[model samples]
Target: MAGSFHGLTVFNNNVHAQNSDSLSQADIAEPLFDIEKETYIGTILQNAANPTFRFDPRKGKSPSAFFAEVDPTPSAPGINEMVKPPTFPNVSPVAPDGLIVSSPGFHFNEQNNAMSAFQNALVPPKPNITISNSETDDGYNVFSKAGCIKCHAGSYFTNHQIIPADKIGTEPSRAKALAKTAKIFAEPLLYSPTENVPIRKNARVLKIPLNNIDEQQLRLGFAHDGKGGYKTPSLIGLYWQAPYLHDGGVAVGYEHNYGLTGTLLKGKPVDPYRSIIALVDRKERQKVIKANASLHSVHITGDGHSFWVDQESGFTKKEQIALAKYLLSLNKGRTEQQ
Candidate 1:
């Protein structure tokens, strides 16, 4: 309903929202998905903390009133290394923690509350991440020049808006997963920050002010007749968290810098610069995509988001390196306020 993130984590929010949307469960459609009471498993949340990596510690975004999310066993997280693609559902999702999870007063424990605070306080490692070369600095310009900055804009590197399949142009399979959750996804209802976990019958509810959210942009966030939305993720930590794309399939090894089947699965690290090259360089990406296919990896197409930075797009190798280095350095020397 608004621009700011209240609880931020989408799938996790579904677990809590099931409480608020308790009534929706009564009429939930078949296939019995996550967020629907039937699909819920009580703990060990599948959510990752990628969204929290560079999040503003000062503000709380979530399912209550501001956060954005969905069901995608089917998908991923920067919050948890995510990308809103419709990975075919491979496993069941565990529910969010909270005694009164069925209500706004969810994740009731004091430690649970503290954990959230700590998560936002944590920052991605940025030590020596940026290259010392002059080209590294120019890379950011190249990124913006190549239109990478359009969605990957702002302090955390994400505008936090969902881009539909057509414009994004990646393989559309993963979106099939996101579209499913969009059906019953609703704005979150949160208990007042001061409310207790067990939740009183009469408790104060936090008003997640969103009168400032861009209504048009919000509409653009959704897909399939406004049911699903694919959030553009924050590009905070690209150095270590490689094997790019939503499926962790767009991988390349240190030797050849190829695909998931050729790299990470075999315990090799993904060459950041080379892998990034493949991401924006279609010729290179075709090789990587083919490599990912060797294993028939689940949802690992590593295709789409047709933004390129290679010579084919009229850029030089020098500029491509600069862009990759800048992306890797996104973690340091800046606060979320930037």
Candidate 2:
């Protein structure tokens, strides 16, 4: 028996021992098999400890004890399972500072109200110019006269309804337009009437003055005055639309020319009456020039002549700041849904 015990101990040494102190009886009950002897020492020990050690021949041996095992039942998920859903890309909740003209005053807390009042006072309202054309009551007519509606028409401030001029009525056209325009595929554009359009009250909140201005007075000239100039963009939610201009040139300041080339404005020097140049002081003028110079120039062939525009031409610092405020007012949950 001693010799048998020695041989069994030697053979069983090859099998890994569980920490007896840490492991429960259930963990060690399944014995590792001795291939040479064709017997399970761990199981023998378990049966020896019990008087009812009936080796039921009907019961088959367990799977290889050497193999690692995994629990078949799924474990509990981590805390991330409880998190909120992701927001739509590029679209964000309105910042407290981003109040628009059309936004409800009730949304403002006392602190927000104080900040808005300070911003309003700092940026005094510009003189509201008379608009002659009678299209729609709210400055949609001004937008049209300025040629904004050709591209920006519709409730969402974009003509998702219009196919791009280049690829009209084709899959490629829809794809290209979707890529360039934000309103395409955007939740606000698809479901909300005013999603693309910024709230007007938020514009007021941003303190952007939106009175009608004379269209002719704002045209571009030889320095790249209004030749291919797009209509002035709508102020609806202007806060969100940064890096302004159709070509995305001027972001925080205004320029007198839309093209980058000095040549565009060289011959036609912007008519002061029709340009941002007329409103700013010498210091402000320098700021506009600096901002315009920072942008890249675009060249296109026209009327047998090569012309360039700065692309940053129409935005001024004052206008940019005010426009941002006006845009903020166009947040969701402000108006009662129709």
Candidate 3:
């Protein structure tokens, strides 16, 4: 519940290139797991008055092409609250103002667009979420009976809505981490192509739509004033990734409890099959949480989402295992089944 703490709230970017690098975190298999998405690109692209970038891409050295406003002050004042495992290349030489490309018309956008298109083309269409026979008889019935299907509905297993921190309470730090960014967005000196002198008259700025966004949800999603929320991600690829939740605090190794450190280490793989059981079985989850605690992992716990598949929830251990197996077996829903 640290007010100024940010744990798993990272600006989502393509990790493909990062994974190949020797310096990257070993757990490259789990991609797109960060809480936030493309902070810099998300900010300047929108015409929102107070466009802010949280992490100063340019700090001790020259700024990156992506550098915007630099917030020199540390996020948290106390040394005890300082961010751990800091982002790389802390220093860089400052680049020219025009080099901070924020406009859609910037030359880099074409390459970005092309790369995006290529990536999209490379992604195969989502497979149908076909329930196996065993899953239909055992897991799906219990999952539905437990009312899990309400939020985790749809073929992808997500309703794609940002649930309020207060409502679906998990870790609050990451949800509230971006509250300061909203202030940055409101800064009149915010960096963007429009801020550049002799602004390009023909620049094609993207006017991001906010039509359907709920006001409360929007504010909550940013953790503005400590009331932000989190998006329910798709459960489609649960097999390939483990250590559930935004902070990845919930993790269990193949035959033992690896804790949160298991999340960072690619060598210690999280047994997705068992982890799902840990997720819904309260007793197993307690063991996982205790393991995560032993690692001194911050802002993460397998505590919330306590709709258990345990005896307390009138479910036997065998039923819980079956439900976990069913959950693990899920894939993208078949169109014909829909």
Best by TM-score: 1
lDDT tens per residue, model 2, 1-338: 01112112211211211122111112122221112222342233334433443233344543222111211211111101010101212211121011111122332222223444554344213322322233123333233433445655555455423222222211121123112122211111111122222222222222212133232322210101212122233344443443333343222223344322332334433222222221222333344335455342331211110111122534344443332232333322212211
lDDT of 3 by residue, 1-338 (tens): 10001111111111222222211211211122232334423333244343443334334432222233432222211111111111111200111010111223333222323444554344234332355686557877888888888888876678878787767757777677555434223211112323332234443333333445566665666665566788876666566667787667778887675566555555677777777887887778888777677544567676677677789989887788777777766554534334
**Where is model 2 more than 4 Å wrong at Cα?**
1-138, 161-236, 253-290, 297-338
A best-first ranking of the candidates according to their lDDT comes to 1, 3, 2
lDDT of candidate 3 at residue 22, scale 0 to 100: 17
Q: After best superposition, candidate 3 residue 220: deviation in angstroms?
A: 1.7
Off by over 4 Å in 1: 1-5, 9-113, 127-130, 171-187, 204-210, 215-227, 294-297, 333-338
**Ten contiguous residues minimizing lDDT sum, candidate 1:** 90-99
**Candidate 1 positional error at 143, Å:** 2.2
lDDT of 2 at 26: 26
lDDT of 1 at 228: 37
The 10-residue segment with the lowest total lDDT in model 3: 89-98
TM-score for candidate 3, please give it.
Answer: 0.61
Worst 10 residues of 2 by lDDT: 76-85
lDDT by residue (172-268, candidate 1, tens digit) is: 5555543444444444344454655445666665434546656554454434344334578777777767777766767777799578777877788
What C-alpha lDDT values do all the predictions have? 0.54, 0.26, 0.50
